[model samples]
Target: MSSSSAEVLLVRTGAAATLDRTSVGGRGTVASALVKTPRLGAVSVGELGFQGDVQADLEVHGGPAKAVLVYSDEHYDDWVAELGRDLRGTGLGENLRIRGLTERDVCPGDRIAVGSALFRVSAPRRPCYKLALAHGIRDLSARVQRSGRTGFYLAVDRPGEVRAGDRIAIIEHAPHRISAFEVNRVINLDKRDVDGARRVLTAAADLPPRWVAKLRRRVDGAVESDASDTARLYGTD
Candidate 1:
């Protein structure tokens, strides 16, 4: 999709973000909403069967919308963050549509302008099991690795109100040469059993070398056994 065609719009929140999970797949609108968090930025999904209602808000933070982790890639259906693309315009159940934009085009720490609303890419989206079955998409986990279009985690850069049909523009917020996806890809290439969990470990394990040390211990122990390090990292023991 072309950058000029890039757009971000706001739809009502059908669900809320979990305090524990930045994003979640559920049956209906979230019963609870954060009292303080803004709901406009959250990415809400209707029942997780794929190609269904999906929305991204343009304003506010702290509520469920701010919590949604999102991503896009041009190589695939782009359902990674967009619901309409997967449905093939069968009519996007999505509350909002991002046109001509997917995870591949966004850069980490980049600020996106959707009218008066602004959002920054916080991190990369992790593939969950439900996304696989809901969309009936095969090799999704692997696709993330090969495509490098892994969707992004968003943080509210500027809080404001947004609505559908709003044009969105991406603004660079960081001078860093590496993107979160690039770092993840490098780590995935070097390590085995590298999934979302492992990616987090590799990305953050550096904060506390002791944590990395602890992982080293667990990884070594798993290697001695029949299990792979990735399995142990995921607590598959």
Candidate 2:
């Protein structure tokens, strides 16, 4: 791979290289690639934590049309489930299955070039019970309460088109220290980072200052999300 390129892999919705783009309910066509932006933090499918390409731009009812995409971690532990005795990856309902892009490696404002689709890393996606249920898992909220590998969010920096199997390339932005993983960890804590909250907005154009201050107060100093033993493997905690 070229120094400017990274091997990005995702399961194609179909075997086709290009897809039709539409809203959630609509019959979405396959694309060469997609983009994501952070609206919330922490994405969990079933019982896994992960990062990267957290969401894809969708035509929403009222919103700007960003939705959480689903994908299963390919290289994960397998076990028997109550529904069926089988090996299961992280119990996440990611539209695009991710392999190498650990949550910490990418941050908001970072752009990824998959095939021809230019996606801007918006922020980290938040985990909710809906995700768990979607994947036939239980207590997804609780699992995320313990693990903060929420999916990342993206905004189409330069929307072209995308699909699975396209290679993802990193296009860097300024103040690249904070990553989606770190942002998720710090923001979820009981205490908040007043400064950090504000700093993140710099990367995201839509986020307001009030929200940032609110986050700092939540984290206070202790950066724990689900459990008090909050530690991060991707970005700084």
Candidate 3:
């Protein structure tokens, strides 16, 4: 698939239930699988999420701006090599597994048409301990953060049915032109990049509020401790 026309490789959904493992701190039950089950055919995309999908924790997962989670199939090889295992069943808790698009190629507010639904890139997926728990690798979340391959979230603009093999056609690219990868790099990898943080913060309306707030503090030269915030954002608290 070309950059302009990516294809949905798979569709997945999961129920809201108790996680098989405890939180990273081992203090409480982290009520999320972060592992979606594949769907064989077309599925309805609603304003919040897929028809059968349910987030274990709404505080961090699903919402209007985070209606859907998207990951590229292009990253599978890298992850396979990094993890040294097959990730066929591990959907990374993403709703759509697509091809051709990655963090570097997609930007906040970019619009796309998938099947009959319309979606806009909202923000980058912040790596969390749930990823490590899902993959059985204690450092996977940190590795993902460093790699900048952390996928992205999409806000549903028009609800419709979508399926595997559906072409994802670009509708409108955001004027700001800040790729999700750049935002992740500034926030997670290089907090000292004040200029980059400023650009990201300016696009506040297109990013997650939590990220916008954090970036605001960084750009303002305030000492913002994100360790606890990150943990809370991922519901590992």
Candidate 4:
């Protein structure tokens, strides 16, 4: 393992709310909890998420495998340079804004201890329309995916409380599995990487079933059409 240490820079949470068409350009009203704001001091964490945190779409979000969203502050500078704005704070809707850890550092199944709670690296986040709507950029979701700065999700292993400045120590690292960055690279960015997909599937037994199934499909030669991929990647509007 590298000498880099993971540390929490911020903790954020928010409830789901309805958005009108005007707010989403012309895509009609929708419900989303993507507008996360920093939470002062320690915050309670559970199997689902932080105490007040809510996800509008349980079908795609807010489950055990995706209990918490984590973003690396290491990417914020690049985001600001790309978006031409101050992209700090909870603009990315991550429950934990962390430093010294990125997709390349953690692999699926790695156990992490943060504050009083423990978590496992589950999967790399797949950006959707909510991100685009939040930033008012039509293709920002796709851009994020292609850029490989898509952050990641975590499953609560031992629920407790977390606070800013908490050290994120990896207690158990899954050396056999590919890092989250490699997953995103082969599956999202380099779509033609069949051998890479196979390698991921071979070692990613700890990933969610849906994610495993998705990779299995790709490796088995059942790739989705570009139109379908676009819809899944960006969502409506």
TM-scores, all candidates, are: 0.50, 0.55, 0.90, 0.92
Say which candidate scores most in TM-score: 4
lDDT of 2 by residue, 1-237 (tens): 231544434432211133232222224443322222322322222211122332222321012223224232432332233234332333343445555575567766666665455555655665543333333344443445345556665555553444444556677653645777677765664245657655655554433244466565544653435442222211111
The alpha-carbon lDDT assigned to residue 4 of candidate 1 equals 67
Which candidate leads in lDDT?
4
Deviation from native of the Cα of residue 70 in model 2, angstroms: 6.9
Q: Model 4: which residue pairs collide?
A: none
Q: Give the residue spans of candidate 3 off by over 4 A.
A: 22-28, 229-237
CA displacement after TM-score superposition, residue 10 of candidate 3 (Å): 0.6
Better of 2 and 4 by TM-score: 4
Prediction-by-prediction clash tally = 17, 52, 0, 0
- Writing each residue's lDDT as its tens digit, candidate 3 over 1-237 gives 456678999899888666534534454556784777889888999899899888887776788888899998878789889878866576577889999888898889999899999999988888777777676666667777889889999999999999999988878988888999998898787888889898887678888777889888887887567676467334443
lDDT of each: 0.42, 0.44, 0.81, 0.83
- lDDT, candidate 1, 1-237, per-residue tens: 655676554343344332222133323332222211123543323222112222322332223323334433243355435434453321112233455666546555566765565676655543332233233343444455455655555555555655556676766645553355654453343334334334445434222243345335545543234244333122110
**Error of model 2, residue 63, in angstroms:** 4.4
